[model samples]
Target: MNKAKNVTISVYSILLFSIALYTLATLIYSLIPNIPVNKLFAMIVAFTILYLYIQRITLERIIILLFCLFFSIYTTIISEYSSDNINDLLWIVTTVLIIGIASDQKFRSGLEQAIKRNKKWMKMIIIVIELILLMAVITPSSYGNDVGWGKDASYFVGFATHSHTLASACCLLIVLIMTVYKDKKISLMEYAYYILPIYSILFSGARTFLISVLILIMINVYMKKNSKLMRNMTLLVILSSFIFALFNSSMISKFEFTSNNVYAKNMLDSITNGRSEFWKYDLDLFFNSNFFIQLFGRGFEYIYNYNYLKVGIKIWAHNDIINNLISIGLIGTLGYVYIWFKYINNFFKRPRIDFSKVQFIIFMLFTLYIVAPMLLNGLYQYQHYIFSSVLLGQLISQRD
Candidate 1:
């Protein structure tokens, strides 16, 4: 039993280590962009997670492996086995493992045990992440120079590859911190830590994060079932946010990046940052496809090629509903619908709110996710994958 427990903890540590390494690599990449940090980290974490997963495989695990294999073969065959097939396979495998690890009851339990077993190591990892988040705002980075919003719309990406990446990371960090510290009353000094991610999101210039966070705040406040500390902190955020908005209208107005675009007067284009165009284009393609293709999806390779051929840009639909319709089809999109149904079902079945519970965090994260992916290619992004795993894990591990 002890041996098995230790193995579980070890696997959990590997996941945590991967996240830490990824963040550290991002920071290092800002200084030395040519380093093979990404390659090394991917190879190391991939091998470790795959080995651990196979060693403890069950019938259910075999079924999942077989499904992934089948999907890979189908997509590869359909797409003529392009190089992108390899990347798609890796992404699917990593996503499976992330969600699998999170959903394991023994693994989740071992997280607490591991914290007690080696507090220093866990604290070190947390401290490293905290420092990185702080650096994202205080020092900032030069890499997030995006002209998509507008030529003059410069963003503060910090150590992340893009402004959106930094914004997503900040959102994830906020949820994780709140979930971890849910049971305790955070001191005023400790509560100040929330400002780091909040400010980081603003400077990153991702309105998706801004709007999503606002919705989360509204839901939490309306429920009004959180801890005293959480309530107080939420109130503090509201007060400070008002003050900041009042004094820093110029900074807040930076989100209006579509002011100079041809669609400047178009409400839909302005609000969606022009994603509605991509969404409509992809939806048209999906509708024009044969019934079978519409049911099962056109596959990622097909969508990639089709988008490039149509617009000379290899990109997604920027909307998960449309992305899923084209890539995974209506059948796969229904899986997402089921997830929503389950969350809403659970929400209404309860007499009171989960409040600052991990479930609450998961609910809020999912809420934000539903909004972000509509305008950004967020469904398949690594940061969202990590948080999706946490959300899935919480949903699966908990009982009605």
Candidate 2:
């Protein structure tokens, strides 16, 4: 009884500490607009290491994490690099995840209870957050959606190199929503909750994202039943895509935001330069650059800057497989693939879905979906990193 009580208290304290620390960091980031966010992250990681060592944590776990760290660093150094800094960032994130897995394991019982407490509220919270953020984005100044039609585009708010990236993110979010809530019954209010964002997605005017939505809808319907719903969704997807293309082909027809974005256009433009030339150039760069890179990998998306597009040389090597090859090489990205398949096997074929199973399934589906886009195009860099990390954190939390 004493041991259980002690363990429970320790778990509560840890959860409290985590939330407090995150809140502090978020506040600091908002306050200090000039300091790079990564610097703050580095500080947190350094603090975690010190805290764990002081707490007399087991050396065995640390050693395993160190192995992961070595592989992470090893991968980072070998792959084709657009900029040394982004490569470092990739390795840092990977290492941090390793650490998170170890740290979160200590107080698993209490944390698991707390996580399960939100079953009813989670979907509502997500919907509310999305609406608030969307209103902020679409309104910009909050005056109103006035002046001109598309100029309401914030016409100038450049997030990633491409204007269409947000639409792609919306598509990805929709996939997740469908995955989580497809047949599950909620309420009429919840059904309305999903409809609004989707309507917003249609208005976002991203052809490829629309295509992805179509694919997700078809698959979802197929899973439920190969009936009229599947046929209707397929028909709607085609018609919607066609209508979007007919009206807004010009949105991506020329595709020129890289040079104009805050993050210099050099790298983004290079990747967008198209298959024939960009792949030819990047492939030679990946394979011939180093023997080690060819053997294992450099790391995921380490190539940062060479992805630019010139005016005359409008090209694109946006395919994910080609990009992964150039950046992580064969061996590195394959681990990601292995992880996905492993999780998928457990999610569908396995008998149970207690906490860890659901998280694993979510991550696997997301990781696989991101990989799928690589063959077609490359609009995933920004969103993939964040969502993959989110899913990974959830898994680590559950395992704890």
Q: Residue by residue across 278-323, what tens digits does model 1's lDDT show?
A: 5677889989999998887766667677777765667666666777
* Candidate 1, superposed: residue stretches over 4 Å from native: 36-60, 80-89, 115-119, 130-144, 179-183, 212-233, 236-239, 242-254, 263-265, 308-313, 332-377, 388-400
Give the TM-scores of the predictions, in the order they appear.
0.77, 0.54
Q: Clashing residue pairs, candidate 1?
A: none
Error of 1 at 71 (Å): 2.0
List residue ranges in candidate 2 displaced over 4 A.
1-67, 75-84, 87-115, 120-124, 137-188, 199-208, 215-276, 296-320, 351-368, 377-380, 383-400
Tell me how far the alpha carbon of residue 377 in candidate 2 is from the true structure, in angstroms, after superposition: 4.5
Give lDDT tens digits, candidate 2, residues 1-400. 9896665555444443333233223222323556545344534544544454445456754654554466557664655544454544454344343334433444344434544543344454456435643553555442222222233232311122233444444453444354345444333443345453444444444434545554444444333323556546655764665566435543332233322433234664433333444666667767676777775554554444454532233233466556656555675446444443443343334344454543454445444554555455653343333333333334333331
Give the Å shift of residue 155 in candidate 2.
6.4
